[model samples]
Target: MIIKVENLTKVFKSYQRGNTFGEAVKSLFVRKPIYVHALKGISFNIEEGELVGFLGPNGAGKSTTLKILTGIMHPSGGKAEIMGYTPWKDRKKYVAKIGAVFGQKSQLLWDIPPVDAFYLNKAIYSIPERSFKKTLHKMVELLGVEELIKKPTRQLSLGERMKCEFIMAMLHKPKIVFLDEPTIGLDVIAKDKIREFILEMNRNGVTFILTTHDLDDIAHLAQRVIVVNHGEIVFDDSLTTLRNYLGVKKIISVSTMRPLPELRLPGIKITNRISDYKAELELDLSKYELNKFIALVNKSSTIMDLSVQDPEIEEVIKGLYH
Candidate 1:
């Protein structure tokens, strides 16, 4: 395994004051801080060259786990080893072998062009000139950001800056990269571009650990997903397995050639009716097979078109929380 964690945990201390002034004053001098267990003995491992999605709702300790793995924070308990190095204990050497990108943070100098930051990263990492040039060229080409590299960071669009961020993180060619919400605020086109670049990099043998609220990213990039809730590993399995486990229900949208007099079927509920000719129905797959349902529909109505869709990834994840 390229990454290993066992019984990893982190606790945070926070203080809360009373509503009354007198109570607040008294509590300030003699109050116990609240302890929040951000991570609760979560354990998992990732092999080399694998792309995995680390998913959870807000405050579920996803960021804490990423920070610990990237050497930014220490776990209060448990052990984690990446590329044979303990992250917090060996921060300096460990960082050199890995890369990280947090969406809300900026590693590039605000006033400087990305090209300048790239050069600075080269010096900081002590990357040989030949390797730096080759990597930079490939990154720029793959990202289609050759023209944006020379623009000041502030002048660039969110998508442009994000592409530069990826380049900076990958210039040294680290074995593992941690990306937290890499496409948080980009439009659909920009999101697709970023996903494409990530797929390309993974194909070329770079390991990626991605955390995002966007399920599209997971569907497109991850072969495996590890879902956490309330600081615990609630689900850890391949994407296909996840779908199968949660795929007892399905949505089918049908469009008929003409309006029908009446429509009824067992184990199917019409969720929406767009006129008499078009309707969306929810199917209970456990009670009815898909083929049989389709046959019934075709026999009853003149079908113009139909599409069967699995439940949305968000709903499947939301189910984990309950």
Candidate 2:
């Protein structure tokens, strides 16, 4: 196993004050304690070269878990062992074997060129000159950011800067990378480039742990998923299992040569009626077979066009949350 976490826990202590100004003034002397349990003994393991996604609603302890694993915060209880090292206890040594990219945070110096920041990381990690240049050029080519690296970081677009961020994290060739909302803001093209980089890296034996609200990222990049909610593990399984968690279902979008009939058949739920000739519906494959449904539509309306796809990942996650 590359990562092993057992009964990890975190408790934060805060104070509660009053609403009124007079009460607030007096509350400075007397305050009620509020203990927030951010993590409640969560446990899971990850194997090397596995790309896993961490998902949860807001205030679901996902960030807390990542912080503890990255050695930024000491846990209140339980244990996390990454590559056989306790992250908080062996931070200096442990961090060398890992890399992280947070969408809201920047590691690049704002005023200087990204190459300078890359060199700084190279120095901090004590990467050899030959190896550093070798890795840098390879990533620059892969991301097609060779032109942007020499320019001031602040001048680059969000998508451009994000590409540099990936290069910075990978320079040291860490075994595992932690990504939090890595594709938070970007167009279709940028998202695809970054995803391609992640896949290429993973194929070469690098492990990745991703946390994001963008289910598209999870769908495109992750092989397995671990969902945390209410400071606990609610679901952990393969992406295939997650898609089928509710049941075997497919979204059917069909347009008929003529008008579409009222789809009141068993196991059929009309989600959207585009027009008299077009309609979209959900198919409960467990209750109704695909062949029968297609045949029925063909005979009645003379199907002009059709599409079948898995249920949205959002639906599966939303069900778990509620």
Candidate 3:
């Protein structure tokens, strides 16, 4: 196993004012704070080279778990080990072998060119000149950011800056990568590029634990997903298993060769009727397989266009929480 998390928990103390004036005055003398359980006994294992999705809704402790795993923060209780090292206790040594790109935070020097930050990383990671150059070249190429490298970080667009961030994170050739909402603000084209780069890295045996709200990213990248909700692991399984667990709903959109009257199938619910010849239906996939469902649709009218949409991963996670 590359990662072992056993009943991990983290508590944060929060203070509030006393309701009554007397109580508030007393609290001014001797204050008491409340404790928030950010992580409520989360436990899971990740094998080497496995790409997993760390999923949860906002305030669901997803970031807390990642911080603990990446050595950015300590857990209040239980155990977490990465690559045989306790993350928080041995952070200096542990972090050297792991790379992280926090979407909410930028690691680049804002006023300097990205290349300068690359050298800073080389010094920080103690990379040999030859190795640093080699890795830097490869990362820039893989991320398609060779031109962006020479540009000042502050001047670059959000998508360009993100690409540079990825290159810098990977410059040291870390064995594991923790990406938090990597594509959060990227447009569709930029998001696709980042997704491609991540898949390429995973193919080269760099394990990934990605946290993102982008269901498309999860659908296209991670084969396994671990969903956390209310500070607990609500689900953990392969993507296919998750789809089945949620009873994956399929959207069938049809464009008829000619106008057709209103219709309904037993397992299909009409979501929208775009035109006389076009209609969209949401089908619960558990009840009807794709081929069978399509065959049934074709029986009613001559089909011109049709597409089967799988349930988005966001919808699956949402189902778990709400």
Among the numbered candidates, top lDDT falls to 2
Tens digits of lDDT, candidate 2, 119-215 = 9999999999999999999999999998899999999999999999999999999999999899999889999999999999999999999999999
TM-score of each: 0.94, 0.96, 0.89
Tens digits of per-residue lDDT for model 1 on 167-236? 9999999889999999999999999999999899898899999999999999999999999999999999
RMSD to true structure for each model, in Å: 1.9, 1.4, 2.9
lDDT of 3 at 130: 97
Per-residue lDDT of 1-322 in model 3, one digit per residue for the tens?
9999999999999877789999889988887789888899989999988999988888899999999998889899999889989999999999999999999899999999999998999999999999999888888887788888898898999999999989989988899999999998899999989999999999999999999888888988998999988899999999888877867688788898767556555667888988888988888766667788666557767778998877666676778887
Give the number of the best model, judged by TM-score.
2
- How far off is residue 221 in model 3, in Å? 1.2
Ranking by lDDT: 2, 1, 3
Better candidate number, 1 or 3, judged by lDDT: 1
